[model samples]
Target: MTSSPLSPTETLASARRTLRTEISALQALDDRLDASFHSAVQKILSCQGKVVVTGIGKSGHIGRKIAATLASTGTPAFFMHGVEAIHGDLGMLTAQDVVMAISYSGAAQELMTVLSVCKRMAIPIIAITGHPGSELAANADIHLNVHVDHEACPLNLAPTASTTATMALGDAIAVACLEARGFQAEDFALSHPGGALGRRLLTHVRDVMRSGEALPVVRESTPIPQALQEMSRKGMGMTIVINETRAPVGIFTDGDLRRLISREGDIRQLTVADGMSHNPKHVSANALAVEAATLMDTNHLTQVVVVDDHGLLIGALHMHDLMAAKVI
Candidate 1:
């Protein structure tokens, strides 16, 4: 006889139970944070060289991610495979470096070997394992216990809850180290320069906006036809409607021009004030490009005026500028 497929209700209940078990495991992990965690963060923060993270199998995968997180969050770190470290990769270790070893059982031969080498080199060790009394934990300079009561796996043998707890603990360590170093958003953006998030965080409107002659600015008293001429000359698809003092009070876009021509049937009768949208959304030149994008999106506009704190139009940016800057 073949095993029957689980019913929808049974499958749903099983998934919910697994999730609940993992949640409880994470809560236990959270409750266990204490001086030991603080010491680990301090140790990582004091490291003169890069953080060397190593582990075997599933733990290795988590170690890789932890190393990446630490590296991106202000701590310099890299993952060295435990087994490979015993080979030629041992050269990656230095006396100034700190080793973070991960093993659920804490007795993996490869990890233990690397730990032994680190000990001989006088490198500091931070151990993450379920077994607090195992050789790896006992020998480590700082031991972080990642014990979980149950696995999310039905068989209770696979690393489910344990890995989740380990990852969360790793994130906590990274964040703590980040705070200790006073790492700022600009530093994070530097690390992620190739990603869209980096562009959004690092770029300001002033960096991408069109200023001076490239920006179309016209007085409210200017005729609609002249404003249209200014829009064409600047080729920004919009012109800033400014007051006598050169402060932006409105904007006239291609859309606004089309609507006016369609509704009035004669463009000669309209002035810049009549065709322009009053009190248009504006952004500061120093604001993050993402914030400018948000303002444009919130106002249903393809372009927005960039102003200084005094409400003087300093520059202008089109949605295309954000796309070109990779801040979209």
Candidate 2:
């Protein structure tokens, strides 16, 4: 029987099958992690200089990410082009540095050019490739085998699964090394200071919450109109209603004003406490913005009153402020 030309449905099915096969291949590869993997971790952990990652083509792209991940995770590393190394960039290599060469076939000519230079410098070469017995692997101090049995691409010729496996292996290496060195979240956040998670972990409420005279505050006995004036003057969505002790008792918002007017209530006759939402959500000055965000979300609030340990109104934080600060 002859094979028939695939219909559209069959073509899609074939593509899905390839991806499934490649995904399974990675799972199979995961089981192979053992003492050798641990040994590689030890080598990187003890390195005195930066781990220089290099490759050509698709492998080069993966190498760049590996270098960045390693660098950001406490391992000093950077990427150098294999071709550039021979064209005077070889001086970037030091005896103290470790060379990481990446290739799918372990036969990229540009990588081979730099591998010999690494050898001359007495630098330890770590290779990540699909071919363990290939020259690039055999020439290295340690070869991280990233072999994939199939490609996620329908043609079975693209770098899809191979790159995925390489990336996973790079992450595995970085994590193992990080754990061995007892790396902490604070350490990781320091390198990712521009991201939301970093801001949440580092930014204190005191750093961004409105304070000083700008804080929205009004006495409980103050008339609803006066409290509305305070809220408007402060530009905060709500004003903190407080007693003589200067401790917060309630809060009044634009939302509350709408509801009070809808009831045909007299704003001038009402007290600040009458229009306030008692038991309004509050945060401490030292609280993390991320915690504040969670509290605001859970309480269905757009703003939170910031108070000191004594429950005295200190400042206020709005949802927009959190968004601008990238805390959201």
Output the worst ten-in-a-row residue range by lDDT, candidate 1: 193-202
Candidate 1 ranges with C-alpha deviation above 4 Å: 1-3, 211-227, 240-287, 291-315, 323-328
TM-scores of the candidates are 0.77, 0.79
Candidate 2 per-residue lDDT over residues 1-328, each given as its tens digit = 7989999999999888877876786897798777768777888888999999998889989999999999999999999988787788888888999888999899988888898888888999889889999999999988888888778886789888889889989999998888888899988888999886689789888888998898888887898877878888999878888788878788889998889888866667888767678877899999988889899999899999899998888888998889889888
Instruction: List candidate 2 stretches off by more than 4 Å.
Output: 1-6, 147-161, 181-188, 242-250, 254-281, 309-312, 324-326
Residues 30-72 of candidate 1: C-alpha lDDT, one tens digit per residue: 9988899999998888899999999989999999999999999
lDDT of each: 0.92, 0.87
- RMSD of each candidate relative to the true structure: 4.2, 4.2
Cα deviation in Å at residue 130, candidate 2?
Answer: 3.5
lDDT of 1 at 327: 88
Model 1, global lDDT: 0.92
